[model samples]
Target: MPRAVRSPADFWSGALFAGFGIAFAVAALAYEPGRATRMGPGFFPFALAVVLSLIGLATLVRSWLRAGPPPLGLTSRPMVLVLGAVVAFGAMLHALGLAAALCFVVLVSASASSRFRWPRALLLAGAVSGLSVLVFATALQLPIPVLGRWLGG
Candidate 1:
């Protein structure tokens, strides 16, 4: 009898995780991974890769052991919109500044949802922008401007 996948989604997800983990692990090997006490540049990446690979292996095993929901069909709309939002964020960061770029990103990304609402999206954008400014600008002291040249900052 031919073997069949119990959970297609889990199987694919596991494959993706394992692939990325392996790739990153290999790349991490380029840098010296020091001991736990004195971790080198590659230590963190290597550690994360190991964990990810283990999780992927476990998920792959589980996929064969238990049934799960049907695999979801691909949808291009959300993907395109989300990718566009990222590109927009990058482009607008310097021109529009961090806060405005973040807000635009939020609005554009939120629009990808079927149940998107302008009001809710706006609120979320404000909150995210404010928190990002506080964390990245104030706390971390990054040089990202609050308002860019276009915004008269």
Candidate 2:
């Protein structure tokens, strides 16, 4: 008889990482990667892909050697909420601008957790929005408006 799967989590995680790593590596090849001392646009991504692939391979091998609990069933609520938050952020970004988009994303995503609380979610949203503004607007001076034209910018 065939051997039973030992560690489903490790196996699945490894497969996912390896798949992403390979995809990234292939995509990075389209750009020119310079030598390590003189990095090019593709250099960092290619290097990271190599490291990720190695880690995934190690994880896959380990799954066969170790015993672990069976993989948990997928839940739709958290997945839907988190994905919806990302889509909402993208859709609202141009109209509402970065700060509002960040707040929406944070609050919506926070609700995905079973332990979500209004106070905590609001606090987290405020912190993330402030930090994003500080980084992207004040520090980086990105051209993105703090408030969009729709908000009387």
Candidate 3:
């Protein structure tokens, strides 16, 4: 059906994204040389910022091609859950540690799905969190904190 089309909202977001990228890229220019050749801590951020700015420019171009006013849709439930989990994860990172935090992240993320169930949530959360902890802490030596002082280092 050649039915309906919704106009895109303000291109300001693209501009903002581009602005953030520019800021990061500028900051990265000051990065000091590290062990691996010349690139240091700021290298990735600077590169990412440039990429973000390009994306923003592309989005702005796309927006300019659109015809008229746009309708932006926002949903409450999923937004609340995802944002809440992210905030909680940030807050709990020190105390709860990676394993616990990953569990929370996994379960909360899974719960965002309409098809999510308790059993699946539990299984997936445990498996994903466990594997993440093992790989990061053991294999990669990422210094991921474990839940308790006794259990982790």
What's the count of clashing pairs in each model shown?
0, 0, 0
Q: Please give the lDDT score at residue 86 for candidate 1.
A: 99
> On residues 55-93, what C-alpha lDDT tens digit does candidate 1 reach at each position?
888888888889987568678899989999999999988
TM-scores, all models, native as reference? 0.54, 0.54, 0.55
Candidate 2, superposed: residue stretches over 4 Å from native: 1-71
Candidate closest to the true structure, highest TM-score: 3
User: Mind giving the per-residue lDDT tens digits that candidate 2 earns over 35-103?
Assistant: 778989999999899889888888788788898876796899999999999999989888988899999
> 1-153, model 3: which lDDT tens digit per residue?
012322355365666777888888888878863555766787677778889999887766656666446546677778888888988888787777888888898888778889999998999999988898888887999865777454454
Where model 1 places Cα greater than 4 Å from the true spot, the runs are 1-3, 35-39, 71-74, 93-153
Best-performing candidate as measured by lDDT: 1
Q: Candidate 2 lDDT (Cα, whole model)?
A: 0.88
Error of 1 at 32 (Å): 1.5
| Candidate 3 local lDDT, residue 78 | 83
The local lDDT score (0 to 100) that residue 125 gets in candidate 3 is: 90
RMSD of 3: 8.2
